[model samples]
Target: MPAVTTKFNEDDTLDMEMFEVNIKAQLDAGVSGIILGGTLGKASTLTGEEKQQLIRETVKMVAGAVPVIINIAEQTTKAAIEAARVAKECGARGLMILPPMRYKANDYETVTYVKAIANSTDLPIMIYNNPVDYGIEVTLDMFEEMLECKNIEAVKESTRDISNITRIKARFGDRLKVFTGVDTLGMESILMGADGWVAGLVCAFPAETCTIYELSKVGKMAEALEIYRWFLPILELDINPQLAQNIKMAEVATGIGTEHVRAPRLPLIGAERERVAKIISDGLAKRPNLPAYKGLSMA
Candidate 1:
């Protein structure tokens, strides 16, 4: 799952009790791995100490049962390397790193920025390539420069360009694993040969998400499409600017998360809140019992 962040008390402090329970829920439901402080995790507002605390607690809760990837969204090359070092020190198994934050770094600077962070830690890196949301696009040409960074092993393709899935496989082949970062495109990406998914609505529908992936991978396209069609409305929740609030609300409706957010982000209000709640409700009311897959677990 593109894991959600820790719940907060009304005072905006971490609700450690709810947070631990939420972690156990996802693991029990069979999410392959977890992302701590992703975009949906609201990494922008999380403090340095909070990030460390989040990682340490998650590593303990998971107990190496799954890989926990901490996101690095620092603004400068130096800070990026430092944050990478910090994630490594805190026991993160991998990182989902964005390009330089705030000021748009040009090609040369972006390439060196990734190299600096990769050199700082031995942990495998998944490059976050969502030009639609993050401005700087990590094109195939830019990736050519990144080939030297062998530790960089995957790409989170939120470019919303599904064709890039084939392009990357055609070009780099198995050198990099490609994950569909957009929830709406998860099944299509898998069917098109993308390696996996880094999803948001999975915060609310973990089993369905895992089932869809496994079905598509196993050539049960008919079964996969049934779930995907029912899922399109809920999947739409992950693509908007209010994604943090939207996904959190879905989690609440499903009894897995809360809508509380830190400053600069408020809980949904008025019609927006009701509208999202309706979508979650409708999806759950008609939720399907996915067929059991005896294959190796997607998780």
Candidate 2:
């Protein structure tokens, strides 16, 4: 699953042309799903109507080839439930939801918020446990409380603690799917048994990112590592505060996207643009000739 960037026109309108192009690349790369309107998608700046439109169009374009998931990051439980409702109504196959965005809710509040959204819609849910950036860790205990909700099927493990994969498996077994949300740690996490990758830099380099996951899952570590090592510098861009600009710039390099971003967020300028440009160029110049891996076997 790629946490794909939402393409925008220079006028700040949705860039469906480029958006479809990137989505096609990901599907061709053998990704299991397409995740829209996440952090990488600039969900914060998107209007409710725009989000619904995105979900509807992506669902249509995907046409059940793979699941189309919508990210729900609302400030209130009521609004969150509404987001869920919209996702389902617009034909999203699943939802990747964050905890309350406005308030730093405690464990009880957070649990209630997540469960409320889960119960409101029949769509399968993947909780975004990105405390490193989002500031509230969904601990094992909290997951225990949430386990009874059958729709809460997966967790995007963004805690950056590799051990948490072991911990989740130890505590929940196969009850909950685990997907690494960090781009740099994708190979390690999959090797440690993460079910999938909710990737970032994948927006720019879909085949390389998916190839790493597929190779790692099949124990082809040496081949995977070669690409992963080359991919590291580009992956690091995903961790930066200006990741949207950095990755979108890379999309431009790959000819799959544009540099346009929404208001309050500007395109990369001067030194930052030059620095990221060098990384993208270097990575592409040395881009590995991926081995003829046997099968897709996507994570």
Candidate 3:
């Protein structure tokens, strides 16, 4: 596994061509893995068949260059299990699970939710914990309890709480891998002993993300912060749940991918798109030497 260095989220609505382009681009950029149909990919908006196709296409394109992690999220445990099976059948290397939305569940209920998903497949599973999005944060006790599930291999901790990372490292450092889910906290998390980062910003500037991760891995905080500052503005856009949309627009503007997102998660339009474009342009302007913005008409 080589410590599962880098993980990226892909856009679910991208057609096969665009999907292949982005996948190849990220793999070429040297990410350790790809997370298809995750939050950034708008998993909830995708149909079961669509998700399966996306996973299958990604697996074929990646060709084992990097691990492929498929997100299995549905309205029920049964549906999620089915989705997990589809992901495995499609050749995904791992699975990411989110708690069922629309209804708050007790600790016991949460444990059951995770167990059912775990029981569904033998692939390594990583639990996604974002209280703001899922309405529930798996408590430390619950996280520790999840350790009992031999198949559960990782946890994507999205909360800004640094202590949680410390606690998880102190408690399960040897047993389970902990991946920081926030882009801004990546350098610090890596320094604090997280195994890897599941980054949203990597979709647009993977080289920079990889640089930061690599630097942190070797204890070069000074060099890593220099690159981190260059990526901060765009990374800040992720605070809003519409991060995927914003990143898609940046991709379109930077000639990476189309800004077309599925409904209920509309495309950035008018002033919003222009505003994002300006931020990206400004950030690039500040870094004249970085090749990502080379020949890019930031205006």
Best by lDDT: 2
The whole-model C-alpha lDDT of candidate 2 against the native structure comes to 0.91
Candidate 2 structure quality by residue, lDDT tens digits, 1-299: 99999999988899999999999998888889999999989889999999998999998888899999999998999999998888898999999999889689999999999998998988999999999888899999999998779999999999999999999999899999999999989999998889999999999999898888888888878889999999999999999899999999999999999999997989989998899999999988998887765484644
Clashes of 2: 0
Clashes counted in candidate 1 amount to 0
Residue 73 error for model 3, in Å? 1.2
Which residue runs does candidate 1 get wrong by more than 4 Å? 294-299
Q: Model 2, 238: alpha-carbon shift in Å?
A: 0.6
- Pairs in steric clash, model 3: none
- The order by descending lDDT is 2, 1, 3
lDDT of predicted model 3: 0.76
- The whole-model lDDT of each prediction reads 0.87, 0.91, 0.76
**What TM-score, over all chains together, does every model reach?**
0.96, 0.98, 0.90
- Rank list by TM-score: 2, 1, 3
Using alpha carbons, what is the TM-score of model 3? Answer: 0.90
Candidate 1 matches the true fold with a TM-score of 0.96
Local error of candidate 2 at residue 186 (angstroms): 0.5
